[model samples]
Target chain A: MIEKTLKGKPAYWIWLAILGALIAIGWACYFRQYAFGLGLTGMSRDVSWGLYISQFTFLVGVAAGGLMLVLPYYIHNYKAFARITILGEFLAISALVMCLMFIMADLGQPLRGLNVIFFPTPHSMLFWDMCVLWGYLLLNVLCGWVILTAERKQVPPPKWIYIFVAISIPFAVSIHTVTAMLYCGLPGRHFWLSAIIAPRFLASAFAAGPSLILIACLVMRKYADFDAGKEAISKLTTIIMYAVIINTFFFLLEFFVGYYSEVPGHIHSLQYLFFGLEHNGEVYNNLVPFMWVATLFNFTGLGILAYMKIFKVFDYRLVGTAAVLIFLALWTDKGLGFVFAGFVPNPLEEVTEYIPTLNELGITIGVWATGFFLLTLLYKIAIGVEHEVEQ
Target chain B: MMDNKRRKFLKMAGATVLAGISAPAIVKLSSTDAVASGGGQEAAAGGHSQSAAGASSARIRLGMVVDMRVFYQDQALLDVAIEACVKAHNIPEIPDRKSEIKWIWKTGYENAFPEHSHNHRSQILEHNQFAVLCNHCDNPSCVKACPTKATFVVEKNGIVAMDFHRCIGCRFCMAACPFGARSFNWQDPRPFIKRYNPDFPTRMRGVVEKCNFCGERLALGLEPACVEACKGTGALVFGDLNDADSEIRKVLDEEFTIQRKPSAGTIPSVFYIV
Candidate 1:
């Protein structure tokens, strides 16, 4: 079951070591969750969700973000995407794996998760979200794998797969949108109750997720020789810029609604998140200010990409810097109180705060490292396929 | 002294076991097969809708009316009423602090409604006393938000009922409800349930629970435990909202009464005369 080497150096061992360390960390932290229960996390009765769920939400969006790439490549016949569309699909599979892992970690009784499917309640957004994310995960993996295998063998891919990829675009959007509905539908929770939440979620996903893919492409080009060509790279950057614009626009609308409405419930959480209101006490501390800086970094990064003449070469340093910022900015905004801002000052006017504990932080790191390890392995096999390496 | 104390404890324990073993058989032998229905005249159509009952009554409207002004005078009475109801309903007392599971209790003046306060601590009177359990709204949003029909408004009498078996503990109902009526059970209930009440349904962990207006008691034509325990002034009144001749209707007609958070547009079945 084991494959030995890349370039005969047993590079797979390096990947195995990294993955093993992550799994060990995951096991150690998991024991704490079992012993202490959910109390170990920052979640309280008022703030039912925290960083773990937020990351799951963001990661699902990223998995769907691949649709923006997949659609143009398959449906519209964009030749530029042809070289690296398999990479996008591979990225999506990894994103889906991370999304599921986060969901599993968030549950109080991990064994009970099967109940969501067994007793399917159509009225619950979570039920739909569970179904859609799972469906999208399967479609992308199967279709992407089949197509990649065919390409490796110098054979024609089954014509039906194009239809599957085509079907996956809107289906992918549905996966993230349903996840958004889980929050947006609540009436009193001002932050999440927005009508624009589903759209905003999709927009952010497109920007954050593909931006990740573009970063991954750039990374591969540097360390390995999977150079998908400058033309393709330029095209991906262009798409990333456009997605970022959508993401920026979505934020603008969200901010406009928050400030203009003047409803204390709606406005207070956003204020608490950004301005550090109420003596900058317990919950709203260092990270609240970072939201503003995140907006700036995202805009500035998008601006650099938009103004093509400024950076003629598409320098790796500039790309990496901008990508890292956009990634962090979105992560902070989505994965923290930005999504939670709506829920504070609950209908009862009780302020329950959320701050991820050491155990929660450790569990999150373990999950992330596991995701990267799986991603590294998948990409290795894929690039090996493209290069016609022997099995 | 230690030997005497141990003997005393053993004697008490022996008596408790003797009572426990004989008490059930005595009751079963004495009582007939008939289910006890306390004497209350039913309307021609019965209390609740037959479709909802699937067995017993027709459409029934369950409701409550509390005289808040009078409630402010008594803390001991309120505690007794809540304790009685908790015992009758088999509700647990799990003490995680955060997940405070309460089927019925006093919400003193300030804590009951913060927006309506005239002074800093208007909710708490000279002593702790205020609004009683859930209002059980006519258009209960909690019912609307519950993905499973776990939490529902029984159509006949409009009692908000929770089917614990179906509940997934998503807490969406908690967020959607304006009254903050619902409570989540963070831990299992078995450890905390001190006594068994055959009339009321017991809850599981993670599912939401709240005041059910003592639907089981009302079904048997008995007043809710809270109503029976309120004593002297009789501050708590359980009745059929649809009946114009009921005491609840009389209070609504004569007194300048109000429902909690009326602006919420939930049209609460519970009313209060301050």
Candidate 2:
């Protein structure tokens, strides 16, 4: 089973080598951060949380998005999804690895990381988030490993694997909900306190997760002589189309409530994100550009997906392009827009902008590389098992 | 006259440390508390430990009432108070505004009372610089956010305390504090501490810290260093809120007082008299 991932073309090894170099550089940069302090990053007294935390928030959605496929195939018994369910599960395992890595990179004291567990605080949302994340990661690892191994042996998976599958269905939803709760429960941060934050997270997760998988499936089809079938691809495109609509609708609802309610606490962050908030006669709207770009991408991606669904067109390239657009839009909206909105015009009605330094960016890229490295291996093994068993 | 008293107080604290009357676990081999300055937060005399003996009665809710009129009249009074606190606690003087650590700070009405600053307000209120520090809330959001119990409210004294060694420096507390009270040591703080107070310890990098309501001073049967510095000014008052006859309670009852972000439901122990 392990040998499948080891045997690859020169292009594959070259890609791995590049990632290996990035991982090495990222770790080297992290060591410098550890020796110095978080001062190496662009975060400050007002904008306390920056790139690492925002990235953690976005990737949690990506990990939770894997459940869209798992729930449909296992519970609803959607046969069209059977060909790609393994892809979703493997993607989850890879994304969770990145999620955990980003969290470690953000910690001020990574060595005392166990303190969260050593002093298990049930009252804290972080305590619950840690519990749910590890639980979700373990469940996906078990489900993916067992299902794929069983497929290669040409036998049915253990009857008990469904119980884990059943648990993971809710686990997927729980991870994003718990992650949102981390921000929402803080009374001071008005931007994160929405009742629909968890739902918004799930919507974006559904959109982003499948978008990446759709693009990955297309890549696998071209590079590895593997086809996930036309029906499965079309079904996934429709799922992404609906997810994008829901995600965009959720954003519009936030916009309506922020402006219509006319609450300064509620509107300040949104104002800062979209148009820039004025503080002390200086307009502190650094996030304005990225946020506007996200808004454009979201509506444009939404328009394209809606048009495709209505026309009943599923050309691989057209759908692939839409998926890329939707994925980037959600990533920026949450990663760039949401987290900064929470901190700008900080508690004191003062603005302190955050811009990640090169060192922080290096560590971030390293963490992402590690995640992709895991992903490439998992996908390779899953596909190899499929090829060996299908023959 | 006050300078002599401050020197005497520092000498006594130094003498106590030299005599080694405290538990060996005290952060500094001197009786300095961990939260006050240095390491071994879970060890004795780290602010939360019962070793802070005389004031360990759980019934007492410590509180402060700020009379802004005194500071408004003589701004130097406020400056002296801030200097006293920074010196006693060894707060780093980081040049970068973002990374600077503060136990107490001054802000105008626009920042001090963000909710009330919009409309045409009092010129007097607008001019006076309000002193802000940790609210040490009765129901603190930071206590709930900390992944590790590094920061917790001491039930006995009703004071929020930090264990520097235990803090993983996640900065969740910074976000949880509505008043922007907490500061993270972004760089090694040792270099920035200009005047080392042997009576207190200095913290390392990568930990969150803020005003402890002078818990270490209270342990030594002295008022907080800031209160002591402002003794004659009538600007800053510290007393046990639970005590019916305490000065803070009387001040609160008589004056029109306010707390930062009352709607956040933190129930700040610190109050301001407009």
Candidate 3:
């Protein structure tokens, strides 16, 4: 089935070529960054983490969000998701790849990253995060491949696959929970020190991951001639509605606790995000505009998604726009606002705003391209196999 | 000639890898008696809580007392203290504060202790500077966050030290520290050192480093460079906090000293006499 990638039309090859160029540029930028050290980027001592970590956080949600599809299709035995379960698993595999790449890109010594494996500290949440991410990726790869292959051969998937599938459900939840623990467990950064962080991560992930899948299904239907059935698409749209609402409510819950309680630690980080923080007689709020944009996208996406579900309207174009909006909103919330704003008024109560340099953005783009490349390749295999079974 | 040189390089690389594997054992054998424990979490626990491990009575918890009143009288003393540590550790002089390597540095009082400064204070307290360094906490969050135990609390003396080689440069320790004590080598630091202290090994481009409380100087029966340099003003005092008769303990007995961010629950060893 790997041969399917080679069998694409000129447009497909052109897309591959573009992705290849981006990956190459990213690799070169990473090498330059590795040579010059992490200073090539805009990260300072105050804001030690930047775009790489932010992207890694967002992608972790994406990887776990696939569980949205897996739980409904396998556990609840929702027959509508049968044709699309493979898509969710494969998307997870791709997202996990991007998560890893972003993490590697962020490391100052990429060569020594294996020290985590060499001397594993059980106390560190990072060690657990690494373990669960790799575990979830392996589960997805194995299950997605074996089940898809079984379908292509016109045989029922092996019975043993169900055991792995059951284990994967909790494995999905663990990846995001441990990832949240990465920030929330830290002492000084009051913004992330919340019990609700894991829940917010999951809610945002559920909405973002499925909406992305909706767009991918539409793309596949138009390009690859693979329709995943109207029943499946509409059901997924409903899932997005619930997830987006829960996610927004979670954001509001954070605001109420932080502001209503009037705790300076909690209020300052929130203030830094939604409104600019006044620090040392100067207002530092570079992320303020981005946060508002995310808010605008969030409610707009919510309104459209809500309308579609409320009126029993299932127009694919409007749904696609809503999906794209919801995807961007969550990406901004998790990827940009969550980590970026959390670092403001750092441990020393000094606000040092971080903006990623072009060099950093180049590396980030490269990682995303590589993820798409893998996703496109994996998806090509799945669709090709589907095209074969249909004939 | 090129093939011959390649083979020669490969042989040397193999030898270096072999040496790397055995270096830990050699360092343990040759290092200070406490480092023989290699800063293990179990030993650190024994040093902290006597009942937990019933560890030896020789488990000394070193601490520092910074007399901000004395230091603030002569603010230049803060720079002197910083100079002493920089000279001792060969910390690089990077102009960028964010990426600069600092073993010991000064921060404003309000920034140092946000909880303590929430209310209006005496003008002296508001304007004064505080010398901040690693607390070598009773429960060090950096040690817990470090995925490879690159930064660990020494069992013998309760000094939190960094092992640069073991640090994967993840910067998790940086995020973990509430005091902004840890600094990452954003770039190769050798070029930035004004005057290289050959006595100390310079950290590589990609690693985290911070105050070891002059662990090497302690082994040599000398006080930490900052404490020694401040002997004239008598602003910095270093002694075993566990020892009841120690000067640091006496200072705590007499003065109304406060630790930075007491609510953080790290139980910092460094105390400030406001």
Candidate 4:
């Protein structure tokens, strides 16, 4: 079964080689960061978390998003998802790997990462995050492999596999919720302290995760001779549509609470992000354009999705455009804006701007390449098995 | 044979579930109870005696109170105290503001207490500066956020301490701390040390550090380095908060004092009197 990945066309090898080159470049930069300490990155004492942490946060959502397919397919008995469930699980595995890599890359003492397990503090959300993340990854790997093997054999999966699927649903939800708790539980960061953060994280994750899958399916259809069926795609598009709506609504609720209340603590970060904040009459605003772009893309994508759904019209081009737009919108909102916004008006009541250095960006690209490489290999094996079963 | 295999699988699953349910409780009971009971005995013993040896043997809730009125009058006193702490801790002097590591530093009143300030506040209050450091809070958010107990509260004393060897440098503790007390060693601190203190060991790059309340000095039956330097000026007072008769307790009872961001519910042991 593993040999299927080796049987790909020249295009597949080229893709693998590109990803491998990016990963090698990333590791070379990482070693420089390791030698010089985190000083090589753009993080300051005031803005302690930069690209690495933001990526970790975004990827956690991507990892958890696999549950959207798993829940409807397994619990609700949606038969259309059977062909693509393995894809979702494999996507989750790759995303989790990236999440862990980003964390390691961010650490000042990367070698001592095992200390989280060696001396666990249950009080820490990070400890629980570590537990659930590893547990979820194991569950996905076990279920995906076992179920795929059974499919190859043309037999029903073992009864125990059902338990794994049942457990993974809640586990997926917990991973994102715990990641949100990492930010929300902090006292002084008004931008993240809201109770709505966990729900917002979930909504955005649901939208982003399925959108990535839709794109992947499109790629698979064109290149790998795999089709997840139109019905499956339509159902996923509906899920994405509602999720984007809920995510947008939740984001607006944050603005309303911040602006209407007019608490400086609550409004300061939003002011810095949306409308440049004035500090000592020296107006400094870097995030305004990025945040506006995020807002425009999200709402426009939402409108497109809603219009299509309401009219009972299925345009693949329109749907694909919406999926890409929504994915980028959420990525910008969660990955780029949210993490930095929390650090603005830092604990000292000073606004210190953070922009990632080239070194940091290089490492980030490497992590993404690593994820895509794993995703490609997994999909190749999954599609090959499915094609053989059909024959 | 098939039925027997199914029975075996079900039995194994039941056992796994049972173990999973009971593990947390068992861990909680053993770890918490042992540390709590042990800490209790030490605190009781430390309270009865004010001797330095006794303080070392038992738990002491080390706290500090700064008299801002006295502190603002003499700028030299603050400098001497800062100098002493840096020298004692082997803290590096990174000229770069972005990467500088500080155990204790001076901050303006407005920056220290943003939530408490008003537009109508007097110029005197606005202009006054106060020395700030780790609060060693009763409910430290940093300790809770640390995935590894690398940064942990000393059960024997109320000092929030760090194990640099164990720290993974995730900076979660830095985010959790409201006072901006913690600093990361962004680069190797050894090269930047102007005058190396052979008494204290310097930390490697990539770990979070802050004021340890001079835990090393305290262990050696000595007052904190800062307290020693600020002596006779009556600006800084360090004592055990657990003992009602201690100077820190008396200062709290007599003067109207305020802790930085008391609304944060961290219950900072450091207080300020203006």
Candidate 5:
């Protein structure tokens, strides 16, 4: 089963080589960060978190997005999803690995990260986030391995696997909820301190996670003799459409509250991200263009999906394009705008702009490469087993 | 037979659940006790004579009041107090403002009281340089956010303190702090220190540090370095807020004081009379 990943075509090997090289370069950059401190990054006292944490937050959503397929298949007994559920689980495993790596990159003392476990503070949301993330990762590995192996052997998975699946349904939700709480519980960070953050995180996760899977399915059908089935794809399209709508609505609710109340603390971050903020006759807003791009992509993606739903259009190409757009839109919104907004008007009311240094970008690229590398291997194994069973 | 097997499985499951739930609770209780005892030993080892005298008494809530009017009159007095604090604490003098670690710093009234500052505000209030430090809040968000108990409120004196050795420097405390009181040593602070106080210890790279309300000095029956330096100038006052006769409480009673982001509900011990 493990050797299945080694027996791929020339293109597969080339793709793996590219990811490996990127990972190597990323590690080289990370060692520099370790030798120096986070000072190597563009983060300052004002902007303590940078690209690393933002990526961590975004990937957690991507990881949680796996449940969009998991819940429908396992809980709803949707047989159409059985063909692709393993892919979702493997995607989660890869995303979570990247999430943990991103966290390690962000920590001031990466070696002492175990202190979080050794001296656990339940009061801190970070402690719970660690617990849930590790738990979710374990659940996915166990479930995916057992189910895929059973399929290869042409047997029904043991009844106990269903229990793990049930637990993972809520466990998946917990991972993103706890991640959101990491930001929301902080008192001073007005952008993240909203009760709506958890729901918004889930909505975006459901939208982006399945969209990634749809794109993966398309690639699998093209290259690996695996089809996620048209029924599964259409169901996912419906799920993405509704989830994207809910995500947009939740964001608008936040905008309404921030702008309508006109509280400086609540509005300042939003103003800085969307429109440039003017302080002491100096306009400081580097995020304006990124914010507008995300807004355009998100709504346009939503409009495309809504049109498909109304017209009952089942064109996979158009839906796939929309999925790609939605994926990028949420990725930018969560990974770029969301994290930066929380720290923009630093607690001292000083606007210290943050632009990621090349080193930071290198390290981030390395983490993403690592995730994709693992993802390719995991998908190879899963698709190999499915192909063997089909034969 | 089926009933017996079902009963056996249920009992086993319930017992496992009970054990799992109780295990963390027990550890939590014991750790809390450990922390309480550890605080006692710290005070004893540090030999805070004043705390020893009041060991059996009610917990003291230490507070500070800054008279911005005095600092406004003579900016040098503010610098004197800050210099004294930096010297007494061995705070690093990182030349780069991006990575600077500050125990106390000067900022304009607009930055200090951003919510209060509006367009067309008086020039005096706008231009006034106010000294801001950790408020040592009764409900400190930093202590609550610290995963390792590295930043905690002292049980004896209510001073928010840091155990630099234990800090993993996640900087969650920095984010949690509404007052921007905490600072992370982004690099080795030793080389950056222009004047190191041998009595005070310099922190390592990758640990957050902030104003500990001069907890070490108060332990030795002495005033905070900043308070002592500003004594004649009357710009800074430090006292037990719980004690009615303390100067901090007296000033609070006589003057209408404002706290930084009081609406945040941190119950900041530091007050200002603008």
Candidate 6:
């Protein structure tokens, strides 16, 4: 009882209060979406999908980061990651929740989402995607819970927990690949209809995902007594660098195919996405400049990381800046170009632009804030539990 | 003890997976075997076959023929076709917007005949108003991609039918259609029910809709609205291709014709004479 009482400082209450306020604001916005139909969104006949899908794609990549820690710790027996596996599992739970929230926000009738199960369409890639996401989430949640319970009870975790972790590594990769198949299977949309799209998504996801974990490690080290070690950080960044290199290669290959074919229909979409199409000004501007900026950030951050001497200064600031830039670039590319630009010169060869309305923007912000607030509360509860057990 | 539990768990999982994968295949194969047995019994008993009775009309091949010459200078005729369709079908007016339910629309000389280069190009430009609708292709791509049995090419009538209720709104049919004939209602269209087309059914939001070749009117011994409204001067001809003496057959025998976007390999039922 005294351990529980000692766990919460005044600062914990402050963080909790701040998070509660953000949750309130986000919930108010969610209510507004229920009042109005999907007309509140920027989606139209030309561009049926918009911001919600883009957010979902980004969050799924973040969730895939859990495997980065889990794979090394379990299969490879990297003892350094043992203490941090709980943190990774908790982060996976938060990321999966955000992914589900974004998808639900994008649906026409959020309540009818369960119909996906009642009436399963095996031909739809979405059904497979849903199964993979739910499976991965449950795998991590169960793995974390059983392990943590054993730790608190001062006993070895059930041997079956490692089996779950072993299964989850490949399951993690499958989750993001199934997500990529959602767009890659379409024949007409040249931008998304490539075989390499899933690999590219995984590459970029791994790159940005590990960078986020590295940043989280730095922060926890500073505030808490958790030191994940410099060697682990270095090793994680090296893996991230390889992912970035592959991601850059994919971007170049996509451009080469588009320009080489010189097929007006295929080339026109890339031109519209990267450089504005004839007379359509700054429609996909956020995508073109920001994507290149992302490439530059990845290269520059990797360059900084290459120097062993600079390892001493590899604190939250430098790692945080790199993570923000990489995350921002990828988020813009997937959200803006992947969703809206596919519709500019529609199948009829008519150029109709899609711009999200105010209501859509409001609801999107609410969804994001809700995700953040939920993550904060979950982290607080987790950290508090860890402290109580330690005492 | 823990190892024993793990091995047992693995065995249980393996059995579950094996059942999941093979159960469907076994069911599918056994059903086919039953059908094969049923066919053998029918053949042995000498069943009264469908082909023996009314074998001539065994396949009702539905088709349409449009004459461009009558519509060359008649805007009133085109207006009548559109208005008559709107009235007969109870199509709601979109109010300065184009709805997915358009049964008729006019195309200019350049768009209508991109390939045909006649010596009388000036004469052709002076008079050309072509109304375009669904080609109702013989080898339709739209029918191939529909996940549900929502969109299909009817074997008996040679017409395409869209079952809206069965549509999961995947919109694969829309992207597959090369002609851009399909339309998706982004928002609720039922509230825009100022005027309703009784002959043609209104569609819900999220599902796709297109010109169905006026399946209701074709059920009766009458022509489609657009075909019937073709200036009443043989601008549009409708008849069975199977009937050698039909008006479509006479037109095909007399005039040289072209189908839209022949490169697509759709083999359209609608034809145009230059």
Which candidate has the highest TM-score of all?
2
Model 4: colliding residue pairs: none
Q: Taking the tens digit of each residue's C-alpha lDDT, what string does model 5 give over B131-178?
A: 999999999998888888777776556778787767888888988999
Clashing pairs in 3: A45-B98
DockQ of 1: 0.22
Candidate numbers, best lDDT first, in rank order: 4, 5, 3, 2, 1, 6
TM values, all candidates:
0.82, 0.94, 0.93, 0.91, 0.92, 0.75
Query: For every candidate structure, what is the RMSD over all alpha carbons to the true structure, in angstroms?
Result: 9.1, 3.7, 8.7, 12.2, 11.6, 13.4
DockQ of each: 0.22, 0.74, 0.60, 0.61, 0.53, 0.11
lDDT tens digits, residues A158-269, model 3?
9999999999999999999999999999998899999999999999999988988899999988888889999999888889989999989999999999899998898998
Ranking by DockQ: 2, 4, 3, 5, 1, 6
Q: In model 6, what are the clashing residue pairs, if there are any?
A: B89-B197, B89-B198, B90-B196, B90-B197, B90-B198, B91-B197
Residue A337 local lDDT, model 3:
85
Q: In model 6 chain A, which range of ten residues has the least summed lDDT? A: A1-10
Q: Give the CA lDDT, 0 to 100, for residue B46 in model 6.
A: 19
lDDT of 1: 0.68
In the range B1-274, model 3's lDDT, one tens digit per residue, is 4234323433432332223223455433333433322233223334223323223234567888899988868999889888999988888999987688877888888888877885778888888778989999999999989998878776556778777767788899999898889999999999888888766677788888888887665544456889878865669877778767666677789889888988888999999988
- Residue B161 lDDT in candidate 6: 61
Name model 3 segments beyond 4 Å from true. Answer: B1-57
Look at candidate 2 and tell me the lDDT of residue B90: 93
lDDT of 2 by residue, B112-160 (tens): 8887666788888877788999988999999889988788876555788
Error of 1 at A389 (Å): 7.8
Cα distance off (Å), candidate 4, residue A197: 1.0
Residue-pair clashes per candidate: 15, 0, 1, 0, 1, 6
The runs of at least 3 residues in candidate 1 whose Cα sits more than 4 Å from the true structure, single-residue gaps closed, are: A1-12, A277-287, A307-313, A389-391, B1-57, B85-96, B105-135, B188-205, B216-222, B231-234, B256-267
lDDT of 1 at A121: 67
Q: State, as a TM-score between 0 and 1, how close model 5 is to the true structure.
A: 0.92
Distance (Å) between predicted and true CA of A10, model 6?
Answer: 5.4
